[model samples]
Target: MPEPLDAALTKVRELLLDPNLTRAVAAGRRRGQRPSVVRAELRPVVLKAGRRLQISTSDGSRPYTRNVAPGTEAGAAVDALLAEPFGNWHVETADATLQLRVTKSGEAQLHRAAADRAGAEPSGHDRTKDYLLDPGDPIFAEIGGSAAKRRQVDAFLRALAATLPDELSGPLRVVDLGCGNAYLTFAAYRYLAQRGVDVELVGVDVREDQRRRNTELAERLGWADRVSFVAGTIADAVVEPAPDLVLALHACDTATDEALARAVRWRSRWVLAAPCCHHDIAAQLRTRPAPPPYDLLTRQGILRERFADVLTDALRAGLLRLHGYRTEVVEFVDSRHTPRNLLIRARRTDGTATGQQRAEYRDLVDQWQVRPRLARLLTEDAPGG
Candidate 1:
């Protein structure tokens, strides 16, 4: 049993008006929602224009900010927001804190912080990321990238570094599949090198031109000994030593599946893929009728497209789990930078899929009648198939 949403939101309203409200965040999108806004934060700001509430939303790659007067439209917007089935809310005030979390089974839990506890302070970016490539570095300047591009690169490297296991010994071998410009490839090598982690990095792309450009850049950066580029498809890229980490950023359509399948075959310890495009599944959905009671999902082109994206990702996660990987689909960055910011991060786990997990995967594919590219790639002779 939990308090009603209206009641919880009333408390939110009260906290929002409090002068001491330090910060507030609402996140965890509802199922089938189209908005790339997976997370949003609210803070008070007083500009020369007027006093307003700064609402910022991130699709996962970049942040977009909008100011709203604390008036009728703001109240209506908050009301509409509360109507969304977002799974978590955190509101911090000078004297207290309000938190709400909804379980996967739809049970809501409320938590309150002690009155004496101070509200959480705002966090700032780490200016002293000595291990990371500086934005002002000649390499970025040579590439003629914007400040925002540098920020995205730094954020991505920080995330990748966080996922590295501390217990691992020896130099890290990394392969960047579909490494178009190899910005991230160079950044990864630089980040690891600064931390005294010996690294062997290879950037693979289908285009020989990109390979040549990246190789020349690596040499210019004085990393020719440890970093190189190869012209080949992600599915067939050859590296003498297998990679410990396989990265595929913004790999389009079935290319993402190919990268993941390669990681599985190579038994890489970590896999990170930012998928782009959902045309395959959407095309399949258009060719056949959706199952009964779900016809509304495919009744409109936009809804059908959106539904396919969700289903495709869901099936990919399930298939990854089946392959003995712990998978999480999370916002890779804010949507402002790129809408295709969803990241599927899979780390090899100790256990294989349970029978229930396999059954669920089968059920979804059977119901949708859409064979995901990853499923076809990873499950040709799957256990219990």
Candidate 2:
């Protein structure tokens, strides 16, 4: 049922000022016009002297933040957010979660549910701030991601949190394809386990040493029963009871193709991949002349390399859409954290390739005169392949 907008806003302000407030998030533009910040969030933080509410805003590419004292200051901040044309608002306290949505007709629809507990305090990029991944996890001492790696893991897990289903029928089986060092592998397991999720995870790496080291770490952490590592290639790794989610982070060059191909073949429900290099497509671009007048695009070594990265990922996304998956290419983290920051997040859907889609893909490949490894791996029997 819809609630009075003023009433909802009042309740939200109260929650924001409450000392128990865990988090408050506002997303999407309600007015259908782009806002200065794509997303904004507020959470309670404990300072050395006292408690305060921290507000963080992200403009899709970067984040800016500020801290306000509780009571009037926090309420004013909350009012400023409510005044914005954000489509959705969610607030959580120690006891309950409240959600508000603005309808097309300007009605306020609200929902409430019990919350389990206080949210985890993630390790913040700034020494004084909090982030999405807790910095003090025991695994960090062994796996080591507290510094530079923290941003990558936090960004990846934030996507996973949003992608995971609201409810689960049984244990979630996850496979990390080409999980070299397995930093993310351990982080995922620990995060889900802490949430009381019945999750079983497997990390596959071609190197036997990595597998052994990860296995030893898992055993030492008392997670060997639920988390395991395998010494095998992403293309040939045998994960019993095919995974519900597949993660391929930083698989270099065409190795990423191999991982995506394997995930599509398995019909995994979800896939999150962060490609490391576009060497295959870049090398092909160097060998062939750019299509017609666009020759200027590839005339320079640096420009050609950057263009190949864009073209390669675009083609990869188009291919995934043709393969019955809803695909989105997103920057999971800031480029400063890692140059290879593009993450391909896909969810299995009933989408079918239309004649127009197929034609466009074919036309693109013909114009470029370059065969992407992903296309060749996925559509070997197709005409171009």
Candidate 3:
């Protein structure tokens, strides 16, 4: 294609090879990689882990690369590549002898300024990304531990991006239900605001302590004007004028259901929840063991946990589907610090469901004697759902 910068690139290292370093390098070159800038004659494929690339340089020798080691660091490198979704790149001539790099002076200044402000002298703005990302919004970076993990995060982000209204014109109205400590809430606020999207966010949680701390955090981050905190049940939170987006991350037990119910009541267009605790089903299972079919499976402890998780989420998806929503269940994190590791992402859709879904949901609950938290949450108000 065309080399945009004067700096020549050596063989590119796959983030799959060393994600940390690759991410560092990418962060270093972040300014130059902006949409209006980044010019490169580097013919490369952004692969999953190790990048698979073929470039013919001026030497007339085809540049072929592979990161066969595929170790832990390699996986991280891949994640880095995934993290950087905006890298303006292209190839050189057909012969592809020379690789070109284009970086703008303007972009360079931003990185330097950030590094200087952060007091990270030698670390370079490149290496200081972790320091920077963690202080404010670290959602994308923290989602995955390796290349594979990042791929999952990428999918979730993609789903969210797609479901959003194409025209993000006015300020966003967001409600983060059960927003304990409000990590994700704060991250979302920072992200939307940085992207130049106006946002008004409210974090709702039952814990008074979390609300107090989060309020203090909003003030400390200077986001008090853009974000607020409410201490109470997510169901009781006053979501004035409704919300465009509702996020309930790792809300324990029926709290996720409560958040969804509120979102549906408000007719929220977008909803995301990482649910914890399937205790409702486990509790039901304790009362009634099971019939013959389920008896074979519920006999094992590990199977029971796995089954409980699947059953609980399946019911949730069904419930959402019944309410004209598209839903998906996926892993949130591999960390053991918390047991609520699955994310249930749902977006409002116009598609009508097939009849089997409702029947299947009923059958599963009946067979397992599991009364879902969702069923209880919506029972009083949701008709035919």
Best candidate, lDDT-wise?
A: 2
Q: Write the per-residue lDDT of candidate 3 for residues 1-385, one digit (tens) a residue.
A: 3332222222233321322221222211233232211111122345665453322111111122333334554455343443442222221222121111233432111111111223434522233243323221223322223544444344444445555666687767989898876766765664455445667899888989988988875554445666899888887866686898988877887888888888777778788888877777766776777788668677777777777777888888898888889888766655453455677778888567778988888887787777777777777765321
Per-candidate TM-score against the hidden true structure: 0.64, 0.66, 0.59
Between candidates 1 and 3, the lDDT winner? 1
Residue 222 CA error for candidate 3 (Å)?
1.7
Residue-by-residue lDDT tens digits, candidate 2, 317-383: 8888899989999998898866788999999996889999989988999999988999888865422
lDDT of each: 0.74, 0.78, 0.56
Better of 2 and 3 by TM-score: 2
**On a 0 to 100 scale, what is the lDDT of residue 344 in model 1?**
88
Q: Residue 10 lDDT in model 1?
A: 78
Query: Model 2, clash count?
Result: 1
Tens-digit lDDT track for model 1 on 338-382? 777788888998577999999999998998888888878776663
Per-residue error (Å), model 1, residue 73 = 65
State the TM-score for model 1. 0.64
In order of listing, the candidates' clash counts read 7, 1, 19
Query: Clashing residue pairs in candidate 2, if any?
Result: 122-131
Top candidate on TM-score is: 2
